[model samples]
Target: MILHRVAKENYNLLYSIGLTGYGVGMVLVPLFAEFLRQAYGWRGGLLIISALMANIIPVGMAIKFESHKNSRQRNGFQSVPSSPQGCNEGTESNSSTSQDTKGDSSDEIGVVRTIANSLRQSDFYMDPVFNVVFGVTFAYNMVWSGWHSFLVPHALQRGISVRNTIIITFAAAIGNTFSRVAAGFLTNSLVKPVTLFLFATILNIAAILCDVYFDNYYAMLVTTCISAMSIGGRSVLNQLVVRDRASPEKFDVAYAVDQLSVGFGLFLGGYLCGMIADHFSSYDATFKLLACIDVIVLLLIVLVRYRPKSNPA
Candidate 1:
């Protein structure tokens, strides 16, 4: 249970480092798409983009997929009960990989088995910790997807110049990339991912409120940057939080489920954004709604964290 937290290499940091590439792509993709749209009409741009994307088929086929048996053998342990009491001695028989890097050495050797015993048996969603991760993922994706889609429109409505809107987008991309790298560098044993998630969500809501209640081009730029940084932290912590709770073997599956939640949130978020705005007759109504959701989701996570465990029957 503990090694998951104190892994020698710090997987979260590595993961955050990798995600910076995605942030870079965020800035680059728009420029590329715009260029394509201009160089060739929209239809031609789509066709070219489609042709370029088809390369993924060959790339996917070229990668050698690992067998499940090999994967289990490599991981060497399953993640069992997450009682915080640590894994039982019965699991002590499983010899885990020796963890050590130049300056790192964790005394705990029993990297407990995964959250789910096997691929077919995934009771992980029932775990309160996983549920907390789920809620955080869902709300973060829903609100952020809406932000990505509507922030430009919202800024234009506030009379921000198109040139300045582009600046805001650049600012956001910079903030997102910088924050992710910062999170990677800053996170350590004492820093908890859930705590980071909470603070990030708070920052996100605060920025949204600032942008909604007040209107100034500079203010929008600053708040958008703040929100982007908040999102960057959430993006980094998303994997870390789940990493803390899931064992090595189950990490792949747990992460897959987390991603599925993100997809669901994206769909629902766009829908809810439109629906709430139409229902409330205010374009900014959805920001307020998502802010409230942020509060509710935060409260639920707090409750889950503190809820007394039912005495094991």
Candidate 2:
């Protein structure tokens, strides 16, 4: 019961954070980008980003402090139901075996055991589909981050106009924003989590090919829309999978693990695409490589199942 309450509380907090952060950030970036360009020329980009970084550092510190507090709570004294709660002292005595007595310190012990307990039973491990959904979400995030960080610069190096690049970017962001809002609504209504994942996989693959096949203004806009839409849809889908599949007690752990994939994806995408785009004179080659990756990841998503374990809810 405590776990269930904690899970619900966490879900509400995280959902609000995601919505507000993405919504406000997206809305502000175009304006900020324009302001920087006007004020500092090309260097405005650097200045604006630096200012944002300045803002982030303090907020990040606060978050780190809170995270430290939570970690301490998780690692320190453990709680159990009292006798009046129907968990008798004798029951605890019976369960506390030699192994429990052998534990070096209550605070230091149970770390491994706790993790094992969380995932030990059929209630803990995710369904096969959940695995695939997580993988696909991770791969797509890498691709999306790669596109945002490197693709436009590559386009400019290949002689694409600055105005067109901005337009493409704006269009993509607009598509993504609408899709994200729509996805939130739909997840509560029409779409099942797994079905949304499948759709996201298809559209994301299509987005990659858009860069490969089309290089002009109109194609850029369309391809950007595809890319943005897929990512937007997948954002909600990924969360839904965790919510549906994970037991309430383990939801936080599961979601945290899933988000680690996003971090790795961002790192890999930046490094890999940066290396490839730099190595090749043409951005076309980079797009082609990413396209291949997209295909492989899409197939993987399709093959993976989405059902949760068949034990207690």
Candidate 3:
């Protein structure tokens, strides 16, 4: 909702910064968890986290919704007034008050009607652009969930030590942080978001291929960073695509629907990847299959029309 208030050119930048925070959290949380465990044990750590969660309520309350009319007023663009007819001052004042009341009531009715219409509309599900974005988002989430669930186990199986695995994870988080910020700038300055999304998908496919084929510790570490960079920009890109494809009034609904698809993908991806590994007796085969799915995601991205309201900055 806050993002909907921002200009289109800056959306990716803001979204990327948000992703960078997530990357930072991924790196920081493990270190913090280890410290808390050492200092006060797991029960104390859980209590601390529970207490911290309460802060979110106040933070959420601080976010104020700015209406479009208020935004225009702040910009000094007031509504034009009609010419006054030859009437007594008392009659004019009464007429103005009645008009204001009618206007307010009509606005309320219009809002309710739009919501009712949206509830009955199947056009959103049938839209070609929506279908493409939905498919790509689902695929991306599935791949991401699978990688997160299996990457550590896969590394351990390949004979990497616990310390080196942690180092690799740290390296990936660093790559993810930088890449998300860079992706935002790149999307605004160099390429259409859809084009950037396609490139990200390609990077993911390459990273998965490398993970499957490489046995060397350094090589696997590089693949890990590549995969992280690829995953970092995905959520931001998903937001950009949905905003571009849907009307401003429908953005919240569209995003909610997209998130639902993503949740399903995450569940299916994690389960299916584990099943594949069990059947093949290796993570390598599972990654190879993921790479194939990424190819399909890339193709879907290619089909999505990049019709933004404004040109790239």
Candidate 4:
């Protein structure tokens, strides 16, 4: 529980780090396609992805940083109440009893009740804001999966050279990394997520316009910049939403459940995007359609009247 203690400042720094890492990898995947095309040819693109699979090293390092003794110490201190001079030793026991009295049970129950009770007791999933966040994240992931699956192939078909495409991809990655770092700092400093979200929407709109109206290398590069901005912003915001929703006691489980959306989103996104790509005469049509979906979702997020709800578990 202490491990999840989030000062606004610390949250900013860590989220920035996460965004930077995600940007670097996302950027590399697209740019590296050129190398795969040149060194091994188009069909071997999947083989080049083994390099990303090797990214476990850096991920392991990040995990180690979070799990370090110094970090753990801070986390531990945050989880436990500070010692007070006049505190009773049995205070914790009494407090637990008091809480139990609110929803005290007489005896052990059946398996179904146990499971239901556990769900009822959890502080994560019982909120409307989290529900909307899940929806937004699901839409974002779907757009991403569809874009990546067909972006490069579509660009190549549209007279974009693999080398130039790679350059655009690299620039986007670099831009995304910097944006993430900036977002981290800003999140700590700012209170209004809506402002940041609005900015991201603008960027998303610009990127989609670039894709729809122009197919040149320069246009693609600019689109990549917009893509980075939108995605990097969304990534950090999602974490903040999850963090703000749960107390330290249930933070870990809440975060875990929130993160499950990513896996589900990616799986669903990939399958749907592939189907669209397979059926369309041109992948550009699919990209444009996805862009429209992004616009609609963005508008919904902007217009929605959502506030975080209480989870009294």
Candidate 5:
């Protein structure tokens, strides 16, 4: 919903901030958890974290919607008239015309009814761009979730100390934070989001290979950092792809559908990767599999017919 309201130019930046917040949480939570647990015990520490989570309510409340009229005027865009009850007149007109032509009396109801009907239309699912976006999004989420879920365990299995693993993870979190913001800036100033996304995918493959073969602490640290950056960039890049392909009116629904893909990927990726690791008796095979999945994601991204609204700098 927030993405629908913002100008496309700012989408990458705002989304990057959101991703950065996640990275910050990843870094800070572990750092604070032990201290909090030592001071207040596990239950009390968890209670404190829960209390902190409530802060999001106030933050959400702070996001006020801009009036459509004001937004249109500010953007120097023409205002489409609204019906007396605040429904978009153009939408109503189209809906009415379609209803009359098709003799669909069910759609002649209220504004909400018409909107709901439009939302349920199969056109979105049939869109090639949407399908490609969904595929890449799903693949990216799968690899990301699987890696995060198992990276630490893999490190320990390979004879890395818990202390070094924690340090590597913290470094990765920092890289994640910076990379998300850098992706936004680069997208805005240096490259198309799709190009950046492709670059990230290639970088991730390298990182995965390093993780599979390297045993040195420094090498693992480098791999974690590179992997974090590449993975972090994907989050923003995927949203930009969705924004570029979706019609303005359908952006919210398209994004929601994309999120569903992410959820599916997260669940399946983690489970499948774990299963593969168990069967192979090594995380190396899991990393290689993830790299293969990234190749699929890269191909899907290439198939997207992206048309950016602005010229790339």
Candidate 6:
């Protein structure tokens, strides 16, 4: 929200950089969890993590910048008539009355009515463009979440030691970081996110398909790093996919809907992967499933590009 407001049209770069915080957290949490586990045990680790999570309340409260409408209302003196003192007094009285009415209207609306009104304003459910972007988010999260969850485990199953598997995970995170930063520049200039995503999808599908054929650790490492870049690239592009179509003022709606897709998709994808793992004798089958999910994402995003919107109703 703050990024959109601050960057306006230059949102892609800053937003993508901001998103690297997640990738950084992914890298940090495993180290933190491992250290905390050895030192504090699982129960104590959970308690500490919960305490850390509580900081979000204060962090969220810190973003108390003025809203667009509030800024305009507060700075509306530019439109004042320069005629006379009486006219100026009248304008001041009317402005005061309007501000008071705003407060009174909010009080009269009640919480439920206010929420309903906010929903009507958001148009999250009704906007067809947003619906497609939302679907893309959901689909991509399904594959990406499953991929992240399984990467280390699958590497372990391939006879890589637990310590070595962590290296592979680290490599993936590095790729993620690199790709996100690169995406910031790319989105601002030469490449359309859709084209970048398509390329990433192809690489991702190929990496998964060829995983079984890797002859050694280096082969697996290279594949994983490159594949991770694609994963990371998609992560950055996902929100930009929505950003390109919506105005900055509508960013909250876009962010909310996009995140709603992410949560649901992550849940559903992880569940499906769990079911697949339970059914199959090998984890390789789950990679195939992830590939198929990416195919669905590809189709959906292609639709996003080509789908007509002559009548947005």
Best-matching candidate per TM-score: 5
Q: Write the per-residue lDDT of candidate 3 for residues 1-313, one digit (tens) a residue.
A: 6666555457778778867888998899888888988898999987887788789899878877678798778757798987767768887787998889799889999999998886555436446456678888898888888888998999998999999999999988998888889888888767777788888899889888977887889999999999888888776777777776776656777888888989999999999999999999999988887898889888888878553333224
Task: Please state every model's RMSD to the true fold in angstroms.
Answer: 13.4, 7.7, 7.2, 8.7, 7.1, 7.5
How do these models rank on lDDT, best leading?
Answer: 5, 3, 6, 1, 4, 2
Q: How many backbone clashes does candidate 6 have?
A: 0
> Which regions in candidate 2 have their CA more than 4 angstroms from the true location?
1-24, 30-115, 122-129, 305-308, 311-313
Provide TM-scores for the models: 0.70, 0.68, 0.78, 0.68, 0.79, 0.73
Candidate closest to the true structure, highest lDDT = 5
Roughly what TM-score does model 5 have, to 2 decimal places? Answer: 0.79
For model 2, how does the per-residue alpha-carbon lDDT over 110-202 read when each residue is reduced to its tens digit?
A: 777786775655233545455665676677677767777765776687577899877777776677777766666666656666677777767
Shift in Å, residue 47, candidate 3: 2.5
Clashing pairs in 6: none
Cα lDDT of model 1 by residue, 18-69, tens digit = 7897779889877888999999988998999899889979976775645777
Instruction: State the local distance difference test value for candidate 3.
Output: 0.82
User: How many clashes does each candidate structure show, in the order listed?
Assistant: 5, 2, 0, 0, 0, 0
Total backbone clashes of model 5? 0
Give the poorly placed runs of model 5, Cα more than 4 Å off.
Answer: 6-9, 66-127, 305-313
Residue pairs with clashing backbones, model 5: none
